[model samples]
Target: MRRLIAVALAVVLLVAGCTRNSDGAADVQVGGDPGASPTLRFRAPLTVTEPSSTVVWAGTGSALVEGKPVLIDYWLENAETGAVVAESYTTSPKPYLLTKESLGTDLFAALRGQRVGARIVEVSPASAARGMTFPTVIVMDVLATRAEGDPVPARPGMPIVTLAADGAPTITPTTTTPPTDLTVVPLIKGTGDQVPTGAEVTIQYTEVDWATGAVVDSTWSTGLPVSFSLAGLGAWSQGLVEQTVGSQVMVVVPPSFGLGGPAGSELQSATLVFVVDILAATKPTAPVSPPVTIAPSTAPSSSPTS
Candidate 1:
């Protein structure tokens, strides 16, 4: 079991995006709004003598840059079998950091210069995609692109916040004493949509123990933001509510509201400091009707994990 898990993880990390499909490309047809999820239809036995891609719809939003996190809704079909291989339209769109190492070869090739809100159709021959016997047809909708949010002014008495060129934050302790009350500081003021309670939010954060000034954890080290719903994050939800996406914030939580326990226990007593950058916010999408369970794809993909 452990070996199987490890192999699966290796596959996910190293080859999630392989070829578009296994066989020769067949006829590919796509129709839908560029801003929303589009429809994918293609005849079986599609033949792609060579790899091909087309932008069915062009969005007016910002163009996507390589190495940035991107959110997308997608559908994959096996042209030979006429099957829905893997899809996110029935569930939720997935987020992927747009790097060659993380995306499938064909997907990365197809989306390099596309703008947010574009709909793309791509066909990959079996020769290009691995582990397939038929050509694959893929349709994708680019939803949003992650950006380094606006820069905010400094606040006195809070931890000093500085950013690397890529938006990762370096937090330094300014004072030895921890605050007794909750302190919310907006380090970078963003212009994006306000984050609502229970919405899924993507953020890069570093946490430290206030009393000892020791680092607890951080997402900055990985260079990828983590996303979660704010429903049960306790003080996190309180501090982040009403903050706009792309804002960098400093949240100081007392034990009672932050960790929840006696006031003096080592774990509960120490004030916690979190330096967070709100990169994006999305609400839970309504589920599509008559949900379809598509078979997992042979192609490598980095769509959002359920």
Candidate 2:
């Protein structure tokens, strides 16, 4: 994950005017589709007295909410020489929380009220960072960072799932005895690519113990999504392999397929219920590496034997 721009600078709100001298960002010419790298045209040695942002195209998708994750593809260049400084189009878009601290003041202002699919252009004065002696220009494309799909009614006998306003899930375990075998259910069918084994996946999930209905872990509480190799999550790797991006899936894992904890721990022989939102997935071009070990809150120094 790439870090955002320097946070030491002050906030600069979007300037409102029609001429190049009044709003430098409006003077910039942006060309290209929404999701691709944009072609920027402006005179060399451009002078920007203050930071300004101009929306190149307004989006029709959902509005970006505060504290939620925002995905964006950006191209930053030196305005003076019209030289490229950094960009994300060559690789993948980066994710950031929609907060002043996470996106810096200028970026936060530029994307604050925008919706998914919007393209924006921002021009700012020089900063203290290396190679940033001259003013800079950035073009950004907003992308959805949460699951967006057609809701599918879950089959009977599955755990009851409810969603918060921001898309976090709450799983209510059934009163009946838990299933003894692994079960996979797709609660939201996505239109994105199907996940493959060993793919690097980014997800937000809540894991509960079926026997107690207690939420033992949740990515929602942390306020950020996590990405990892799908090689060592036991039933997760098996159940999510064929799932599609932008999907919300529920997986019930028996003790045999669950992440076994230390002896005498509640998770050692417990059934694990997981509600997962698959945000993104990319198949590996090289050999997959083993997943990092995640120690449970009640576990000892040793790693789980699963």
Candidate 3:
């Protein structure tokens, strides 16, 4: 996972014979189709005296908002040698919480006002504290973090779900009796890869109680998605195994399907409803242990147990 860039003060020294545009961006050429690896053309030994960012292409999608999750594909290269350092285009796009605390000042500024599908280039000077002797350039493509897919009509008896302007979901349970079996319904059908069992899944979810129609927990409140192995979350493991990325799903879990807690617990007999947005799913490279279970309280454990 990509982490926040470390910030440290360094003396800014101008490099001789380097050209910069009006925006302070390096005079480099960027060419590529959207959603593909960008081609960069620049003189070797390129250097920048200060950090600069330029949007190579503006997106036609929705504007990026702060305190929300953003997905991005990035390519980092050494501007001095034209050597590729790290990239996400060959792998999967990474997710980040769009906050200054999570993305650091420079990165946050670069992505702050941009919209989804925008491609941005950031140039940074060398910093000894960061172990960089040569300047680096990073190209980033912002992707939609929310579910974007074909809307699917939900089952008649399932709870009603509504979305806020920011894509946070609200669940309203009906007066109808809860189902006795585990039920999975896709509220939105995505075009991405299907999630396999035991895959590490990233999702934004809201959990509601069926009987009281009260919300028990939500990831939107925290402004970050959660990623975990779907091994022991009984209903989640069963229902989400074949779900695709960028999809939104509604799951009805009876107490027998788990997530209500151990026997004799307060919610052990309760029926649970979940509205989940599937962000990303990747198979683990190594064996993963089941996550620890927390003691049940007024709210159930975020990681449901078998």
Candidate 4:
């Protein structure tokens, strides 16, 4: 299993390096019948008819994937080796939040809106293709793509805020401030990062009911971060992305928390104060890759009148 994972990940890095962006995330490289170079391949067996964002490959003019935040089922096969690389099958689409580039789980990688259904076979064990080592072929399929996300903006650096889930405490931002409520204190001031559209984050906070003038739920998260997303998540954590992570937060929620258990159901609405630590944080920033442009096509014709 590890062997397959290693090979698949290697091919992905190779494929990514061979590709670059032009103009920005707005304009990406796509398919065209142009001069072939040792650096790139103009043809791809798998393709996307239409592209969503600037995040597209330069190889084929067609879209390789779809949706802003895409999820895919990917598989890698050795082009020459004829080996199956890796496999991931789940109902919920594994988002290919392929920001600038991905971090971990290289073996199972995907672009937005497209999933490599199954990575089957490996051709090049480490041979140079166009001077770069790339698996001759990779097998993938798109599982799902839509206008859904974790509800975070495209930001980097700083901290991020991810909402909570059911059986857990619920928090909401009030239109006005409550004097008897807790206030978050930030060490520094920055715009903050963007949480993955569907990331579960833990928070340490305090909650005080205005009516009681007493601290109610002033406890930290027992579990890792609560799982939530802007795409599929409901009720809780809906509008959290509006605020930046690392910054202090003041919110209101029910006094009782389920903690994933049946007990602790004292539902009371009050302003909760928190200094949230956005796990897997991201900040708004620009892509580092340079933009590219293709030679413009020209028509040739001439006529003489006598």
Candidate 5:
């Protein structure tokens, strides 16, 4: 298990993206929006090949566009063999969705400037840490894009404070949401290696954006005595939580929280790597039972010992 986690970490560090499957759709985590993915004025050397490569022209990509929202539909397949690995198709179909300004992630930056039904793109130089760079190929399809002022979808897992957009609360409505936060730490010495859900744990952590290698937040739990709820709940509330409490994990909280997007305008995903030690455990008290005493039979004193 530790080995698998270590490998996963290696993959994340090299790939520069986060992946999540939602309702048969994949949310490919990308870097911050820099102003509409750079218009591919020229082809990039460090890139991946997508199915749309042939149909598209050779041009440089755009950084996400500021203010304007980018709406798109994507499909991922092996570039070399056309084998489908992931796709984002909605049976109901909600057309024209923009990349929210408030959120941050890698996709925003990489996918900017790309218009809907425009064409697919490929990226190479398989990030330094992506050990298995030879994954055949990746294909993405762009359906359409919309300018800013378009209605943005309300993302989940964030608190919606009824305040003005401005921090003043009363003057300009603001929603006090948690900043994009995450930590990757190593457990201290003598700290049990396993991260059980019900055990108290400790570790040292550093945080980085899932979309970019930029450090936005970091926190440590050195020798700190803490208990577990086993579900990693109430933990993310405190900045750090183990999905399995012991297993190393990558936690991503995208933009939409008001925090500066990854690399400006790009969506943000906080990826965490945890090496926790069980320091203590919370358990119910055991019940106490009375002890019983035993008596031996007497033989009439044996007549004064003869």
Candidate 6:
């Protein structure tokens, strides 16, 4: 029999660089707002005395929090040659879920507590570059933090859910019989932005069978949350849409929503339960432009008046 667990985790883009230094003048000068691309000005072949970072400008918006998604635009250049090694300016700003696993300690520390719209300049020695050929100077702009959605009311007669200090949920079912229709209850109300329909969401979840009360699968055991498009999730898609970041939800699905359909397995007719914590959500992709078409011009010739 197939299990009903769906684990989708966000892909972390690891950028290697050096440590951050305070109380020192920047060898590389930088300019730009958090909303636009960055402009780096420095002497090519600039020598780095030590690893350090400087907040060229502080953002006046919301402060950044760890373990959440942050949108950032950055440009990395070789200190010696001033050549561009990497950048996200030409494309969309990248979403980074800040963690030691996803980013280096230095880069993660440098971004901690930074506000949306803040710009920073960082210098790292070759040693900090993880044996790269040249030292690096990276200019970054903090664009925005992921929005947390609004809260929903908890439903009655559902399973009781409690969280551990570390944020793992324990589900205790109330009734023996499974629910006939889809049942969704919001246990915790989040005050952040509302999650848009079909947005890609990062979450940790657990699935269990109502009959046996056995956990089919859980993302917590993997030690990290997963990412998936809400629209892509067939059975597990209802309670997540429009949920807020940092909010926990409980969903009860009938056999039709469970994997394998009704004829596939005995458990396919069994009720499925899920507890989900929405960590973050990504912005939808921009709409593409339609193809251009050319047409012949229609005109009349002019005659000279005598």
Q: Which digits, one per residue and each the tens of the lDDT, describe model 4 over residues 1-306?
A: 222222222122133344322322211122222111112122332222211122123322123332132233333433334343333221111333333232123322334333322222222234332232334333333322211123335122212333443112333333344543222333323344444444332233434443443444433332212212334432124324544443334333222322212334342343333333332222212322221111111111100010
Query: Taking the tens digit of each residue's C-alpha lDDT, what string does model 3 give over 75-171?
Result: 7777789888776554345667777766767778878889988987776778786567778877788877678789998688778988898788888
Q: Please, what is the TM-score per model?
A: 0.63, 0.74, 0.74, 0.27, 0.23, 0.57
- State how far residue 89 of model 1 sits from its true place (Å): 6.9
Q: Give the candidate order by descending lDDT.
A: 3, 2, 1, 6, 4, 5
Tens digits of lDDT, candidate 5, 1-306: 000001100111112334322232212222222212212211122223221112232223233344542323233333234444333231101112134332223334445565433433333322334333432222234421211121223334322212222111111111344344542222112211233333222222233343344444332211112222333333333333222222222233334332333455443333322222222222212212211111111111100111
Candidate scoring better on lDDT of 5 and 6: 6
Q: Provide the clashing-pair count of each candidate structure.
A: 16, 0, 0, 52, 66, 13
Please give, for residues 154-221, the per-residue lDDT of candidate 2 as tens digits: 78877899998888898888877788888888999888789888776767788888877798788788
User: For candidate 2, what's the RMSD?
Assistant: 6.5
> Candidate 4: deviation at residue 70, Å?
21
Q: Global lDDT of each model? A: 0.60, 0.69, 0.71, 0.29, 0.27, 0.57
Deviation in Å, model 4, residue 156 alpha carbon: 29
Give the alpha carbon lDDT tens digit for every residue of 1-306 in model 1: 000000000000011222333342344556654334555555556545555566666766677778886666667666567676665564445556676656755567667888876776665555422555566666667764334456667777777767665556667877657778878998778777798877767666778776565777776565455666676666777878899876778988876563624546556666778887775566767654422222211110111111
**Global fold similarity of model 5 (TM-score):** 0.23
Question: Which regions of candidate 1 are displaced past 4 Å?
Answer: 1-50, 55-99, 111-120, 125-147, 211-213, 258-267, 286-306
Select the stronger candidate by TM-score from 2 and 3.
Answer: 3
175 in model 3: Cα distance from truth in Å?
Answer: 2.3
Cα lDDT for residue 76, candidate 2? 77
Candidate 3: misplaced stretches above 4 Å? Answer: 1-46, 77-97, 128-134, 231-233, 284-301
Give lDDT tens digits, candidate 6, residues 100-160.
5455666677788888767776766566226455667776777543223454565666766
Off by over 4 Å in 5: 1-64, 79-82, 90-110, 123-133, 144-306
